[model samples]
Target: MTGHTAFGWRTFLLRWSGEWADSLPHDEARDPDDEAARRARWLGFPPASQERVTAMEERLGRRMPPSYRSFLLVTDGWRHAGGFVWLLAGTADARRHDNESELADMYEEDLDEDAGPEEWREAGIWRRGLQLDVRSDATYVLLDPEDVDEDGEWAVYTWASWRADAPKRYTDFGSFMEAMYREFHSLRAHRTGREPAFVNDTTRELDARVDEARRDALRGDWERALKTLDEAEEYGRPRARGLGDQIRRLLGRTHLVYFPDVVTDPRYAPELLPPLAAEHAAHSYRGDASLTFPLRGADDALVSQVFATLEQVRAGAYRYTAPGPFGEAVDRARELARWGDTDQAWRTLTDALPLWRPLGPDHLVPLGWVADPVLGPLLTVERGRELLSTPRGGHPGEAPAPTPGLDPPGLAWLVDPGPGGGRGPYRFVLVEGVEPEDLPARLGDEDAEGAALDAPRTLREARWHLPRGPRESSSYEDRPVMAVGRAGAGWSFAFDGDPAPFAPRRFVSPAASAAAGTRAVVVWSDLGARRGESFFHLSVARDGTREYAFTCTDGEIRRTGDIPRALDPDRFFAVPGAGAAAERPLLEAVAEHFGVRLPRHALLNGRLHTVTTRSWTRPPRDGETYLVWSMA
Candidate 1:
C-alpha cells in the first residue's frame, strides 16, 4: 500500500492493455470492449483471497513468497507473453497442476543425487516445488520451496521440459516479474510498431529535467526549454541531444531550405539565388546545402544559369545580349516587371504586338515564365490578363526537359574565393551537377556596380588546404615540406625540400587515391614547428582510406596502404627493427598527421635521433661502439 499506489498500478495495466488491444488486427478488434475483455480474461485470472493462498502454502508445506502473494492478491494469475512461455498460475492452479505432479515425481527419481541438506541445496535439488507456468512448447517456470531463504522467498527457475541440465535461475519472484515485464513490453512494441516512451530507472534526475523542459515547451518558453535540454546533454544524456535538434528545427533555426520549384527554366532559375544567398548569410556557413526538385524534365541549363547568374549578379555585370525583337521585348518586359509596373508594361507590349506578329508563335517572347511543360511564348494579347490575373507565387505546371539527380537534393557549396583580383569577397556558389559558365544577365535587376564575376570552380577543383604547423622563426630554413599531385586519375604525394632524389621522393598507386567519382582531400604538411623537421602527406580518399607516403632515409619513397608507425606506435613497433632512428622522419610525419607534440629533449638527443635497421639488428653491448673513419 505504501510502496506502489493503486492508481499507478491501474494506469500501467490499463495503458499496456489498451496498447495490446490497439495492436490487434481490425477483425480481432471489431468490438473494442469485447476484445479488451477477452484479452484481460486471458491475461489476469480472478484475484485470490489471502485465506486461499495461505491454505495452498500449507498444503505445499512452505510459505508463499510475499511478492508472489501480493501479485496473487492483485491478479490470481498472469497469461501475458513471457519469453517462450505464457500462463503463470495462481495458488489454486499451482497446487493441482499436472506440471507440479510431474516435478514432484522427477524430484523423487533424483533423490539419490540429493546427498545431504547443504549439498542438495547447493546443487539446487529440491523436493518440494510449485509449477508457475507452462511454455508454448516444452518449458516450465518453477519455484523451489526447499530453496527458500530467510525472507520466505523461493528461488525461481526456467526449466526446459526435455533438457537434463540445471534450469536458469532467478533470485526471487520480484526478479522473475521484472523479466516478464521487459519481455511483455518488447513483444508489444514489436507487434504494435509503437514503442512506448521509455522511462529510465537509473536517470531519475535527468528524467525530471526532461519533464520540466517539456512543461517549458508547452508554455511556449522554447529558449528555457532548450537551455534545460542543453544542461541535460552536458550531463551526458543522449535523448537530450535528439530533443535539442527537434527543438532547433521547431524554432526554424536549421539551415536547410525547401524550394521544390527551383530547377525550372534557365531564365527564371536566377530568382532562387537571392533567397539561397540570404539563407547562407543567416547560417554564416552553409552546412549540408541542398536544392531539391522534381526529376521530370529538369534541365542542366537551369543549374548552369543559376550559378552563372549568381556570379554575375554578385560581380554586378550582365553577359548575354538580347537577340531579335522578341528577345529585346523579353529583356525589357523583365526589367519593367521586376519594378512593379508589370500591368502597364504588358499593356504597352500589347500595343506593339503588330510589329512582332510576323515573327510566328514559336519565336514569340515568353512573359513571366512559370514552371511548366510547354516552352513557347505567351501571346502579346494574353500577357496582360495572365500577368494581372495569375495567383501569388505563380503556378508550377511541369518541366520542359528531364533533369535527373534533382529529385534527391543536389549538393552545393557557397564558398568565399578570398580577397583581391578585382573580385569582391562574395560567396562563389558551386552546384555539383551544373556546368560552369558565364551568365546572360546580372543575377538580380538591382544595378549594383562591380567587376565581372569569375566562373565558379567545379567540385574537383575545390581543394581543401590541410592544417599547417605553427611557425617558430622567421628564417627560411631548407626543411622538408609535403606536396600533393594527381597520379593518373587518382592522386599522389611527395616530400619536397630533401636532398637530390630524397627531396622529390614521390609515391603513386591506383589503390592509394579515392575511387573514381567520389570526393576526397589531399592532406600535406611540413611537420616542422621549431626544428628537426620532417615531411609527409596522404590522401584521405572519399571511401575513408588513409594512404601514407613513407619516404625512407635512403631516398626511396614507399607507399603503404596501412596506418603509419607514428599514428599506431604499438602495432608498428611490434615488429623487430621497425622502430629505428632513421624512421624518425616518417614517425614525425605521422605524429604531425595526428597533431602530436614531441618532447624537445628527445629530439635533441643524438643517440635517439638517428635510428636504423643496422643499429637495431646489431646493438652495442654495454656502452661500446665501433666507428671506422678514413682520412681523406
Candidate 2:
C-alpha cells in the first residue's frame, strides 16, 4: 500500500488498451480526435531487463524507489496516464531534466517569501529532479531526490507551466501512478451511456462489494455501508466513491457539490436538492461565481415538474418563492437566525418558497441559491411536523392599500418566544403615498445609495443595524440609523439607534410629517425582559401634529387628541387576568385594530435604505434624557 497500490497494475494496464479511455472526459483545450488517437495506445512499452535498470541506477548514482523499479519491471514506459501527462519515461530516458534548475527555482518562488531565510532554505525543491515524462503539454512529472521516505522512495510531483502555482505531490511513483488511474475513472464518470467497467479480479470484487454496500445503505445500515465504500475507494473504485459521497450527503456529512443524474440514479437528489441548495447558498459566500445557480425557485411550471418526478419516488421537499424577491424572506431568516430562533428562520424560508422563477428558460440547475451566510445555521426539524406537511410555491398578489394604525397579525411574533417569529425593541411609522424605493433617498441613503450604484453588494447579504447593550455614543451612533423598505403596499421606516430611535421623543412627529397626503401611524415598543414588561407608544401623526396618540411608560398611560375608533387602551397596557396577559396577544389585538402590516423580514433582515435626518434642537423641557437614541 505504501510503495504502489496493493493491486496487480500489470493486469489492469493490459485491459486499458484500444478504446478503453474513450469514455474519459476530454480537456476543453485538447482536440477530441487527437485525444482519441493518443488514448488508442494506452499500454506501456515492454518490461525493461534487470541489467538495464541497474545500468540506469548506476548512471544516476542512486537506487531507484521500489515502486518505480517494479513499474519498470512490468513496463519500461507508459503513454497517457490521466487527463494530462501524455507519457511516462522508462529507464532509457531516466535522467536529469534540462530545465530542472529553473523549474525548481520557479517552484521555490511560488512558496511564501515571508517565511524568512531559515524556512526558505528547506524549500524541499529538486534542482535536478529525475524527469519522468516526455512530450508533456506544459505539464511535468518529476521525482525529488531530497524528499525520500524510510522505504527509500523519492517523492513525485506533477507540475504545470501555465499555472504559476505549486505542484501536486505524491508519496512515491506508485502512488502517483495510482492517482492517474483514479483520475481516468473520475473523468469518465462525467459521461453516460456506458456500463461500469471491471479491469481485473480485484475490480470485480470491488464492484460486488459496492453493490452490497448500496443494499446495506438502503437497509439503514449506513455505518457499515459507509465503511465498505471507504475501503473500496482506497483502490480507486469509482462506484464506491460516488455512492459513499451520496450516502454522506444524506447523512448530513457533506454536500453533493453539484446535481448528479436525478432521473436515472434518482435516490439522494430529488428529496433534498431544494433545501440543500438553500442551505448551501446560505453558508457559502454571496455572489461567488462557483455558487451561482439560476434563481428559479419561483418557476411553478418547472418546479411542479421536478416535484412530480420526486413524488414518483416518494421524495418530498418544498420549493420557496416570495411575493417579491426571495431575498425578503432570506433577510427575515438571517434576522431570526441571529436571535437563535432557528425553527422560525426555517419557516420564514419555506413559507416564502411557494413561488420561484428561473433566470432563463433553459435553466437546468435544480435549485437556486439563497445567498446569505448569516442564515446558514437556520435549519432544523420541528418535531417532524415540518417534514410531515405538504410542500407549497407561487407569486405574491398586489400590495394591499396601507392601513394606518393597524398591526398585521404577523407582528405578534416579534415579542413571543413561541414558534412565531420574535424580534427586539422596534419603532416604526407605516405610511402610504411614500414609495418603498424612494424611502432610500428620503432617509439620506443618497450617499449610501450613490456608493451602492457605483458598486452593488452581493445578492444574498442583507443589512442589519442592530446594536445591543451600552457601547460607544459616537456621532455616527449620535444620529438616527433607520432602515426604510416596502411593507406590502406601504413603507416601514424602522430605527436602530442606541437603545431606541427618537431622542427627544417628539422627533416621531417630524418623521411622520415626512409622509405625504394622509396621516402616518407611528408605533414604538420598549425593549422587554419578560412577556408583559413592554412600555409602548402608539401615535397617529399628520404634518407635525401628534394627532390621536396613546402612551404607556413605567405603567402610566396618556392619551391626546380624539382617539380613533380603533383605540383599545386596555389591550395596549396589558391585563394579566384578562387572558390578554402576554404582550404578544395584546400586540396581536393592537395590530389587528390598526389593520396596517409591515414585513418584519425587511426591517430586520434586508439591508434597507437607511438615513440620518437633520438633527433637531432639544428644548430643555423635552426631558433630561434628550440625548437618547439619536442618529447622525
Candidate 3:
C-alpha cells in the first residue's frame, strides 16, 4: 500500500482552470482569484477518514473526524495521469505551502479502490486540489470534482474530499461543519453498533469542567465554581497550555472560599501548581485577574519570600556585599571602640552619623513638621551617642574588661544575660545601695495606712498610688527579669542605696519592716479583682512563698511586723532633716515602722507565687495572688 493508503486517504481538492505545475495538479501557475486560471488542489482531512481509505475497521465500524466533514464542502477532485487520484484535505488559506509537494505531504491514503458514487456521496467526500490562493479568509469550502465546471472557474478550496452519509445536525456554521463531519462515523456506528476511536485523545471532559467553572464563576457561585474546577483537577492533570493561567487566577481568589487548608497541605505537591509564578510576573492580562491572580501559593507567600530575600540583601547576610550597614556598624563598634583612637572611636560614631542622625530618641523617623515614627527617640543622634558610648567593646572602660558580674562573680546589668545576651524569659533586677538585712522589714507590713496617700476619713478620701518601676518592663521585653514573687512579668529587688522616688510603696511592701540586726518583719499587700468581687491579696512569707488572702479591702492597707525597730525610720534610715525635706522620705520606711490594720491586710495574704529560689514555695495551679520573701 502507498504511504497515503496506509495512513488513510483524506485529502482536500481544489479546482481551477490552469495547466498543472510539475507532476502535482495545483503546482501550475495560475491567477489566484481569476475564476478560470486556478487549477484543482487537494487538502488535508481529519484522521478518522483515514479509516475509510485504509478500510481497517469496516466490520467493527469507524468514524471520521468532524474536521473531515468540514473540509469536504470545498474539496476539488483530482485528475491525474492514468486515473491516479491525487488526494488533498486542507484549506489553501489554512495550510501554508509553497508547492504541491508540501500539500501532498498531508494526504494520507488511496481512495480510488473503493471510491464509488454512493460511498463518496454518503461519506460526504469531495475531491479538491490544493492551490495558491490570494483569499486571506480563514474559512472556505470543500469541492467535488463532479460539481466543478470543466469550463474553468477560479476557487481556492479545502483539499480533503468528504463522504457525508447524513444530514447536518447543527445550524451554526462551525457547529454545522463539525456535526456534518461527525455524521460520517455516526452512520457507520448506527449501522454497525460500535464505538470509534481516534489518535491523540482530546480533553473534552476537562474542557466541559472548565466551562462549567467559568459559568459558575460568572453567576457568582464562586464556591461551586471552584468545586467544579477541583473535580476537574481530579480527573487528570490538565494538559492544556491554558491550565497554568487558570490555576493562577483561581489561586488569587481561592483564599476566600477555596479550601486553603487542603490547597496548602504539603500533601499537595508544589509541582501540582502552575510554574507560572516565574512567567506571570511579566505576562500581561486584561482583567482583575492580572492584579488579583496569585504568583506563589497565593500572593502573600510570594511577597513574604521576596521580602525575606530583600532582608538578606540589606545586611549582605550571605556575604554578598561588603558587610552591609548593620554588619559594618557591629564590627567597627567592636574593633575601633577598643584601643583604637578615641577620636577615631568618635569618628566611627561620626561615620554612622547619617544612619544615626535621622533617628530620634524614640527611635522614630524625623519629620519637618511632625515627628516621624521611624526616627523617634532612643534611635536619634543623642540617644545613639549614649548607647554607643555606654558599652564600647562591651565594657565600661578601655582595654575591654570582661563583662561585669558576667564572669567571676562579676557585675552585671539589671537584666541578666545582658543585652542581646541570652535565650530568654530573662529576668533580673537592680536594687543598688539597699542593705540585705533591712530588706525583709522594708518589704514587711507596718505602716500600711501611710502607704496610702490619704488616711481613711470619708468615702471621698479614698486615693491611691500607682506602683513604679522601669517603664521599659512591659509584657513583651527585650530584657525581662525573673522576680522572686512578682506577678506576671514583674520583678522583686532590694536596693543598697535609697530608692528613687522615696514613696517606697512603689516596689517595696508598705507594711514590711526591719531592724539594725535581729529578725526582719515582712508583710505585703497584693490586690486584684477578677470577674466580679473576686478580690485577692498576695503576701510574701519569710520563706518566700506568696500566700494569697482573698476577699480583701479595696481601699485600705494592712500591716504586721515582728522586729521592733523594723519600721523605725531612725534604724535603717533617718527621717529627712527639715532642710533635707527635698529628699522626699521613702514611705516603705514608715510603713515598716508602723503597723497596718485593715481588710486590705487580709487581701495581702492570698495570691500565687513563682519560686525564684529553692527557699521559695511551690506555685499553686490556681490562685488569686502570690508572695515571696527571703528568710535569710
Q: Which candidate is the best by lDDT?
A: 2
In terms of TM-score, which candidate is stronger, 2 or 3?
2
Query: Where is model 2 more than 4 Å wrong at Cα?
Result: 1-9, 15-42, 98-101, 110-113, 116-126, 162-165, 189-256, 263-376, 380-498, 501-632
Highest TM-score against the true fold, candidate: 2
After the best TM-score superposition of candidate 1, give how far the Cα of residue 416 lies from its true spot, in angstroms: 56
lDDT of 2 at 464: 35
Q: Relative to the unseen true structure, what is the C-alpha lDDT of residue 292 in candidate 3, on a scale of 0 to 100?
A: 29
TM-score of 1: 0.30
Q: Write the per-residue lDDT of candidate 3 for residues 1-632, one digit (tens) a residue.
A: 11112222232121111112212233334344322322222222233343343352242133223323333333322222111123323322223232333323233243467567654542332223223222323222332222323332222233322422322122222332223233322232223222222211223545566666544433334445556666444433232213322333333322222222222323221222222222232243453254323332444664444334334322223111112363364346433222111223334433442342311111111111101110111122333323323322111222221121101211112112323543111111212133322233333212232221121111111111222432222211111101122111112232111111211222332212222222222322111121222111223233232222111234332333332343322332232232112111322332223221111111111111111111111223364344433221
lDDT of 1 by residue, 1-632 (tens): 12222344344445444544444554543455446545663356567888988988887777777767777776677655354665578777675233443554565456575368764553443344567774444677777766777887777877676778866788877667656654554444334243334334324666588666755543335567678877665544534544454344323344443232222433333333333333333343434223322212457765555445445433423223233564466556444332222333344443333233211111112222221101111222233223222221122222122111101111010011223322111111111111111111211111211012222211122122211443222111122221111111122212111221112212222212223333232333232211233333343333324444333222224455565445543343334444232234434443344332221111111001010000101223465544543322
Give lDDT for model 1.
0.39
Model 1 ranges off by over 4 Å: 1-15, 29-42, 81-83, 95-122, 125-127, 135-137, 146-150, 159-169, 192-612, 615-632
User: What TM-score does each of the candidates earn?
Assistant: 0.30, 0.47, 0.17
